[model samples]
Target: MPKMVFIETDGTRREVDAPLGLSILEVARRHDIDLEGACEGSLACSTCHVVVAPEWYDLLPDAQEDEEDMLDLAFGLTKTSRLGCQIRITPELDGLTVKLPGAK
Candidate 1:
């Protein structure tokens, strides 16, 4: 299992341990975190947008072009923005922290 910390737009945080192989979106759903994956991880929408912590952002693989396209529609895009569904949990991603973007 690995631990993930989610920071809300208002600065609240939730830390939880999740099994390996779960996507960041899945982890949020399991803990009732407020991540809206409108396409249910299908990559069809940008509702699952998250701001990756700078320290952990570099650890994630680069996003595909389609993901980059969807992120363009996200509300608060940043240098380290990423779609939650596109990020899967793995040993290398342990201790990951992401921030939920403000409402669109």
Candidate 2:
């Protein structure tokens, strides 16, 4: 089984099982992480924004224009920021790590 880590704003690290094919937002939600997918993974909101660890960022597929646009509205966006709904879990991303953005 694949696994990933989510770092909270308060520096807590949560490692959880990451089912293949599910979006990061889905995984977060399942584990009771605080990511708010306000758009229900419809790519209509930036509430699920997350910062990918630099080492894992390039492993992810490039975000689509719509996701990029939504990310622009994310609080505390960073060079590795990505919309959680835009990133799907895959074998290649087994050890993925992302940080929750600071609250707005």
Number of the predicted model whose TM-score against the real structure is largest: 2
Clashes of each: 0, 0
Please report the TM-score between candidate 1 and the true structure.
0.95
* lDDT by candidate, in order shown: 0.91, 0.93
* lDDT of candidate 2 over 1-104, digit per residue (tens): 89999998889998999999999999999999999999999988899999999999999999989999999998898999999998999999999999999722
Residues 1-104 of candidate 1: C-alpha lDDT, one tens digit per residue: 89999998778988998679999999999999999899998879999999999999889999999999999999999999999999999998889999999622
lDDT of 1: 0.91
Q: Which stretches of candidate 1 lie over 4 Å from their true place?
A: none
How high is the lDDT of residue 32 in model 2?
95
Error of 2 at 94 (Å): 0.7
